[model samples]
Target: MATTMDHYDGFRTFSWFADFVGLPIDQVNFVLTQFTALILAGLFRSSLSPIAATPAARHVYGLIIGLALGYFCFGRQAIHLASLPALCYVAMRTQNPRNMQRVVLAIALIYLSCIHFQRQIYDYGSYTLDITGPLMVITQKVTSLAYSIHDGLTRREEELTPMQRHQAVQKIPTTLEYFSYIFHFQALMAGPIIFYRDYMDFIYGHHLPGSKSLTIFYDKNSQEKEIVLEPSPTLVVVKKVVASLACAIVFITFISDFPIQRVKEDEFLKNTSMLYKMWYLMLTTMLSRFKYYHAWLFADAICNNSGLGFSGYDERGKPKWDLTSNVDVYKFETSLNLRDSIESWNKGTNLWLRSIMYERAGRNKVLFTYALSAFWHGFYPGYYLTFASGAFFTVAARSVRRHIRPLFLESQRKKTFYDILTFITTRIVMAYMTFSFILLEFMPSIKVYLYLYMFPHLLGLIAIILPPRLGLSKKAHKQSAEIDLSETISNGNAHKTM
Candidate 1:
C-alpha cells in the first residue's frame, strides 16, 4: 500500500482516500472539497431554515464550514486566511470610506504581492495554479466591499450608477459577519462573486420581498400579481450539480485527446491545414471551457442549495435559478458577437469589472477596464497579450455589428445566415485571442498566434481604419461608443439578472 501510495505521492498528503485511490492529490482534494461543500450546504439549509436564520447564526455556520475546509485542503497555509478579514476589519474601524477603500485595496495588493513573492522564491516554474486560486476570489470580494462602502457612505446617491446604488453597503458589518461573507465556503474557492448586499439580503430573507419595484416583464395575459411562494431550490441545485458532474467527466475523459499545447508543436503547425487548424483550435478552446464550467456550475449549485441564489420570477412567472451563475453555457457556446461572448463567459467577473472599473473610468473605459482586468488576474505576460488582443477584437466586432448587422437584419433568412456567420466568427476570433490566456506565457502565446497566421489581428486593424471612411464620422463614433457603454454599464435591467 505504501509503495502504491508513493507512486501517487502528488495525491497523498491531502487525504487518506486520495492515497488509497492513487490519483493526483490536488485533483482529488478539489473534487472532494466541492462535494463536501454541497453536502454542508444542504445540511445547513435544512437545519437552519426558518429557525436559526439570523445573520449571526448564518455567520457562525459559514465560518465553521469555511475554516474546516480551508484547513483540510491547505493545512498550515490556512493561516493566511486571517489576513484579509483582519485588514478589512481595520478598514471598517477607520469609519472613513476613502481611507477604508485605500486601506482595503492596499492590504489586498500586499497579500497578492506576498503570494507572487513566495511563488518566485520557491515554486518558480510551477505556474502558481491552484495554490493561490482562492486569493483571487478574496481579492474581488474585499475590493468590492470597500467600493460598496464608499458608494454608500461617501458618494452621493444621485451620482452613483444603478449597480452601485443597489450594491451599496449601508452599515459596517460585525467582524463575524464580515469574515463569514469573505470566507463563505460556497464561494471561497470558486465564485459567482455575490455582492455584499445580495448576500446580506439572502441571509435575512429579504431578496424575494424587494423584487416588486424592480423591473419584471409580465406575460401579456396575466394582470393579477400572483403570490407565488418561493420554491425550494433543491431541484435546481441537483440539476446544476449533475450538469457540473457531466462537465467534469468530459474534461477528465477527453481533455488529453485535444491538448491545447498541441497548437504550438512544430509538426501540428507545419502539417495541419488551415481548415483543420481552425477546427482544432475550436475543439481545444471548447475543452478548456469545461474546467471552468465545472467549477462555476458547482459553485452555483452550492449557493442555490443554501437558498442564497433566489432572484424572484421571470417574464413567464418561472423562478430564476441563475442569480449566482457565472457562465450561461448555452449563450457562451452560441454567442453571436464578441460582446455577448465576453459577457457570457465568466459573467460574475464581467459584472464586477463593469460595476467597479468600467463605470468608474473617466476616459477610455473599455481600455481601462481590460487593463485592470489583466492586472487583477496576475503578472502573467500572456494575460496582457490576451487583454490587448481582446480590446482590438471588441472594437472590430462592435464596428461590424453596428455598420453591417443592420443590413442583414431586414429578413429572417438573412438574419439567420448572419447569426450563423457571426457565431462561427466569434468562436474563431475568441479562440485565437485567448490561446495566450490558457498558455500564460509570452513567447508560447505569440508563437501559437504566429503559427495561425495572425489573420484576426490583421482583420481588426483593417476594421479600425475602414470604419471611419465608411461613413463612421467622429460624432457617429462617439454616439456609437456611448450606446455600447450604456448597453454594458447604465442598463439597470442587466444588473437584475446578474
Candidate 2:
C-alpha cells in the first residue's frame, strides 16, 4: 500500500502550487493545464500559425500538445486515454460495418465502466481528479464518431436526418487525424463533444463564418452572390471568460457553506424544517452547477480562441460562436419545462443522447435514453436514481405543459404568470433531482429524498397517472391542439405519444 501510494505520489510535481492554492494536486494541475491550453490557443493562431498552417500541421500540433498535457496532468494513467481510442479505431477498421456502432459503443463504454468501477471502489464518493474524466469525454467522442461513420457507410443518405447527413463521416479519418481529434486539447478534459465531421471542417477552415461554403448572399440587383464576413471571437471569448469567472466566484463563496453533504447529515435531516431543507438543496445544487458552468465556459473560450467554435452569423449579422457551447446560461437557468431545461444544460451530451441513443431506439426512447445516460455516467447508484427520476419528471412535465399551459397562453398576462410559476417549479424540481446526483451514494440519496417526503417523485407519479383529459376537457383539448406542446422538445424527436 505504501509503495502504491508512492507510485501515485510520484505524479505530484505540482504539489507546491497545489499547496499554495489549497487544492488537491490533481485539481490544481487540471486548472493550470487548461490555463496553459488557453494561452497556447492564442499562440496557435498567432505566433504558432506556421505550425498549424495546414490540416496535417494542425493535427500534429494538437496531438503533441494534448498528449503532453495529458501526461503532465495524469502521468502513467494517461496512457489509458490513447490506448482505448486506438483500440476503438482498430475495431472500426476490423469490425463488421453494420455492427461498427454497437461494437465501438460497447468497447468504449465497457472500458470506461471498468475505470469508473475501479475509481468508485478505490475512493468511493471522492471527487478527486483522475484519468476517468478524460476517458468519459473520449468515450463520447469515439462512440459518436462510430455511429456517424456507420451512418455514412451503411445508411442511405435519403433516410438520414438533415443534421445526421451534416455530421456523417463519408470517409474514415487517417490514424493521425483520428488521434488528433480524440486528443484535441480544446475539449479533451471537459468536452462539448465536437462531431468528427465538424472537427475536420474546423481544421480545414471550411466552416468559419466567413467561409464561402458556409455563408451566401443575394445582391440588390437580385444576382446570386456570396457574402464573406470576417468573424472575430474576441467578444464571445471575453463574455464567456467573464461569466466563467463569476461562476467560479459564486462556487468558491458558497460551496463550503452549503455543501451538498449537509443534507445527508443526521442532525440536519432529523431537525431542520422541510422548507429550509428545500431552500438549502436549491442553493447547494445551484452552487454545484456553477462549477460545471465555469469549466464548460472556459473550455468553450479555449475553442473560440483557437478559432474552432465559430458557427455562423446571426440574423443581425453578428457572428455566433456557439458551435461547441456546452451550456446556455439563460435558457438553462430559466427553463420553464423539463424538455427545455434538459436541452439547455449539457447541450452537447443531450445532442449525443438524442442522435445516438434516443433517435436510434426502437421504442421507449425516453426510457432507453435515460438508461443509456445512466449507464454512460457510471455504475453509481445515485446516477441511476437521478436519471430514473428525470424520466418520471419528463413525463409529468410534458403532461402539465400539454394540459395546463394552454389555459394560460390565451392571455399575455396569464402567460407571464405561467412562465414565472413554471420557472420556480422547474428550479425546485431540478434541485430535488440534482440532490442525488451530488451525493452519488444510494443510502444518502434515498435518505434525503425520504426526509423531503419524496414530494417530487409523488408529484411526478400523480401528474403521470392523471389523464390529460382530467386537466383538459374534450373541447379544451381540441382547442389546445394549436398549443403545440411538442414544440418544447428539441431535435424534433420528442416522443409524442407518451
Candidate 3:
C-alpha cells in the first residue's frame, strides 16, 4: 500500500494535525515550549521540600518529552502515558506528608488512563509500551537476573528457589519505537541527561543546601567547586538574564534549520555558490541556538521570578537567586583552565551538571561530562561525532591556551594579522559546531556532509571562538543554595497553582 508519495501524504497529514491542534510545526516552537516548561518544572521540584531526593522534577519536565514519545510511537491518534511525569513532578513538590497517598493514587489513576486509552486506540506493539512498560522491564530484568544468580548456589531443596525470591525476566520490545518513552526527545531533547538518582536527591536528600558534590578532571588539583551566589541581586537576577537571552537567541535562528542536518551522501552536485554555504551554516546553528537560549532563558527566568520578593540568604548566609537553578544545589562550580563551547552552554543549565557527572568524575569531570553529554544528546550518529571531535580538540585547545595564557594575560601578544586569523578560526569553529548540531537535529541529511568535510575544517575555527581568560567577565559570583519549599513557593498558592 505504500508508495513514493506516501511520505508526502503522511507529512502533510501530520502538519495539518499539528496546525489544527496548535502545535508548532517547526523546531523553534519545539525549543521554546520545552525549555520554558522545564525551567518552571524544575522550580516545582525545588519547592517540594522533598522528604527524599528523586527525579520527581523530571515528572514535570518529562511531560513534554512524554508528549513527543507518545506522538511518535502512538501516532497523533492518542495521548501517551508520558504526560504523567509532569503531573508527578508537580504532586511530589508538595511538602505535605498527608498528600503522599493522594499523589500515589493520582499517579496510578493517570497512568491507568493513559494505558487503557493507548491500548484501545493503539495496539501494544513490541515497542509501544504503556506507563508500566519501562518499570516492568527494569523490574523483570533485575529480578530474573538475581534469581539466576541465587539458583546457582545450591539445589532447590537446600537453597532458595527462583519463585521464592527470584523471578523470570520480562519480555523486551523488538522495535525501538514502542519504548520510545525512555528516549524522550522533547523533555531532554535539547538538554543534558539527568539521572534518576541525582534528580531524587534534589527533592528529598537533606544535606546542606549547597552541599552536593562536584569534581572535574579538567582541574589538575581535582578540587571540588562550590557555586557561591553573589550578593548583587541586581546583577545575578536581572542583568545577566538579558545577556543570556541575547547570547542564546542570536544563535537560535542558526539552529532551527533542522533540515540542514541530514548528512548528504555525496556533495550537492550543483553547489558552487558562496551563498549556499552561508545558508547551510545559518540554518543549522539556528536550531541549536533556539534550544540553548531557551534553557538559559528559562533558568534565568525562574531564578529571577523566584527572587522577586523574599530577599534572604541561605543557611550558610549567602545571597540568593532562585534556588531552582541556583548553584548551591551542587557541591561546587569550579573553574577550568580552558573553556569549551559545549561545557560552557551546559554549565548554563545551572545545577544539573554539578550534581551529576561534574561531582562524580573528580579530575576528569570535564571529559567525562562531555562524553556523556554528547551521547545523551540522542540515539543519533552525528552527535557523537560532533561531541567527540569537539571534546578532544577543545581539550587540546585548552592545553595549548595554557601555554599562551601568559601572552594574552600579560598583554605580550598584540592583535596582529596572525592573531586575527586565529580569532576568526576559533569563532568560525564554534559557529560550525553549533551549526552542525542544529542541522543534524532538524535536517538529518547534513550530518554526512558535516562529518566528511565541515568537521575537518573546524580545527582553525576552534581558536576563533574560544574566549581568552582575559575576556571572561570578572563579575561577582554567587554561591548555589538548596531551598525550603515554604520559602520558594509563590505566596500565590505556589504548590496549589500547578
lDDT of 3 by residue, 1-498 (tens): 112222111123344544555433333333344445445543543453332233343333344454553344333332333344434434434524333324533464445445544443444211122233332222222222222222333224344322322221122222222223233332233323322322223323321244333432434677654432313345464544565566555654444344443334235424434345545554455444544454544444443432221235678876555433322211111222224233334432323333333443557666675664553333344456566556655655643453343243334355253356455445545555555444344344354444335553454345444544335333211110112233234321111100
The reply for model 2, stretches above 4 Å from the true place, is 1-10, 47-52, 209-229, 469-471, 485-498
Q: Return the TM-score for each candidate structure.
A: 0.88, 0.92, 0.42
Q: For model 1, where is the 10-residue window of minimal lDDT? A: 2-11
Q: After superposition, how far is residue 161 of candidate 3 from its true place, in Å?
A: 43
Between candidates 1 and 3, the lDDT winner: 1
Native-to-model Cα distance after best TM-score fit, residue 117 in candidate 3, in Å: 24
Better of 2 and 3 by TM-score: 2
Q: Best TM-score goes to which candidate?
A: 2
> How many pairs in model 1 have backbone atoms within 3 A of each other, for residues 3 or more apart or on separate chains, i.e. clashes?
1
Candidate lDDT (C-alpha), each: 0.76, 0.82, 0.38
Candidate RMSDs in Å, in order, are: 6.1, 4.4, 17.0
lDDT of 1: 0.76
Candidate 3's TM-score reads 0.42
Worst 10 residues of 2 by lDDT: 1-10
What lDDT does candidate 2 reach at residue 355? 78
